[model samples]
Target: MSSSKNTLLIILAFFSIYVIWGSTYLLNKIAVSELPPFMLASIRFITAGLLIFIIAKLMGKSLAITKRQLINTSIAGFLFLAFGNGIVVWALKYVDSGFAALEISAQPLVVLILMRVFQGKKIEMMSVLGVILGVIGIYLLVSQNEVVSKEGSILGMVMIFVCMVSWAAGSLFVGKADLPTNYFVNTGYQMLAGGLMLLVGSLLFSESWSSPNVWSEKVQWSMVLLVIFGSIVAFTSFNFLLKRVSPEKVATSTYVNPIIALGLGWYFLNEVITAQSIIAAVVLLTGVYFINTKKKLVIFSRFHK
Candidate 1:
């Protein structure tokens, strides 16, 4: 491909990742009404994993990875997909889609803090300021009676926090671990490994398959869409963007998702979008901007590693 074409492809990949992943919050809430959240996520990822694995093989990609790589990737998959994603899916049952997205939007800041602690990376002072702003935004979000009045909303918020932290840890570990040269191959294996673990968790923790609402067509199609768009296409494009763009640029998607989710909620479900919520969202996004400033610094040290 020519330089112009390569740049265009990268831009396209970034938008695809941002739009598709942002849409998953609404889809998750829709699915959870008639399906067990964990079980639905398990089915979505398992299908997506198998689809990606098949596509990779058809493209003449190797499935085999080093044992060390497999172990590391599997651990990341379990933490990020099973724990991070699972918590989000489960939280959706108790929280509004837009609120859930807003809660999890703190992920970029969390990743920065975790990287500083574990990787010995220097964090920018601006990023610390951003974290403070972001926390204040979250307090505003929770202060609203709408969120705190619900029985499980507080627990739901806690679960979403777990999702954010676990995902940060997963990303850090994946960055540290040796991964496949091919992004598709690495993603496929990780999805497969993660999906299997989620499946086990679903079976142990949920009676989804036996639930009266298990086989609803509405729920089934939602799972199908989540797999095709949310898991496979969204994630594959996102991993591609991680390599082609700066982490700060990639992190912008966290802020974007809440807007998308809010719009979808208002349009599809007639959910109310209060003024307070919008203000809180902006504060949160502003905080994220500061938090991601650390990635903008240029490093020229040969002794860094």
Candidate 2:
């Protein structure tokens, strides 16, 4: 493919991930009303993982890899999917899905902080300012929603913060790991590993899976969409973008997702969107933009010789 084609695909992949994954917040809210949140997420990921694995194999993608690579992929998957998405699902049991999405929108800024603390990189001044603005935006959004009590809101915010940190670390680990040569194969195996961990976690945490009969059709359909569009389509496209573009660019989807979710919630679910919510969205997006666009720092190492 030409450079132009790759760029177009990259952009499309990013957009697809943003839009599809964003809508999942609303879908999850509907689904959890009728189904156990964590269990539903487990089923979605497991099914999507198997589907993607089969597709990768049929496409003749190589899945053979060293033990180290397998371990790395599993770890990344566990962190990204299990803690990232899994914990968010769990948190939704206590908070509104839209609120959760808005909170996670701070991920780009979190990534910057993680890089500084873990990777010994310097935090850019713009990112520092961006984080401040983004945090204020989050405050405005949550205040507008009033989805939980003040105390519960504080806890919910903390949970999403942990989720963001886990996700950022997982992404960085995946970038550093020597994983599958094929992007699809990597995505397949990672999802499979992550989904299984999530299933086990749900079993251990919830102690039992609720019967399907207990769920309404709306919930069931939402789970189906989560599996099809959220886990399968969005994740595969995300991995594709990872291959075609810089990770920083791919990370921009984090900011875009909240807006998409906010819009879909308002339009489809008739969720109320106040002026504060709109202002928060703008502030958060601007903050994320500053974070993602910051210039990298280059340092010489004495060991380079």
Indicate the TM-score of model 2.
0.88
- What TM-score does candidate 1 get on C-alpha atoms? 0.90
The runs of at least 3 residues in candidate 2 whose Cα sits more than 4 Å from the true structure, single-residue gaps closed, are 143-145, 148-151, 210-214, 294-305
Model 2: lDDT of residue 241 = 64
Tens digit of lDDT per residue, candidate 2, span 1-305?
79899778777787778899888988887876666656777787888888888887788876787898789878978888878888787677666666678788877777667767777766667778888988899788766545556446667677888988888777666656777777777777788888898888877876467776777888878888888888888888877765554444566677888777777777777767667777888999888767656353122111111
- Predicted structure 2: clash tally: 0
lDDT values, one for every candidate? 0.78, 0.75
- Stretches of candidate 1 off by over 4 Å are 1-6, 210-214, 244-249, 292-305
User: Residue-wise lDDT of candidate 1 within 68-155, one digit each (tens)?
Assistant: 8798778878877888898888898888999888877777778777767776767667877888888888888889997889989999
Error of 1 at 100 (Å): 0.6
**Pairs that clash in candidate 2:** none
Q: What is the lDDT of residue 247 in candidate 2?
A: 48
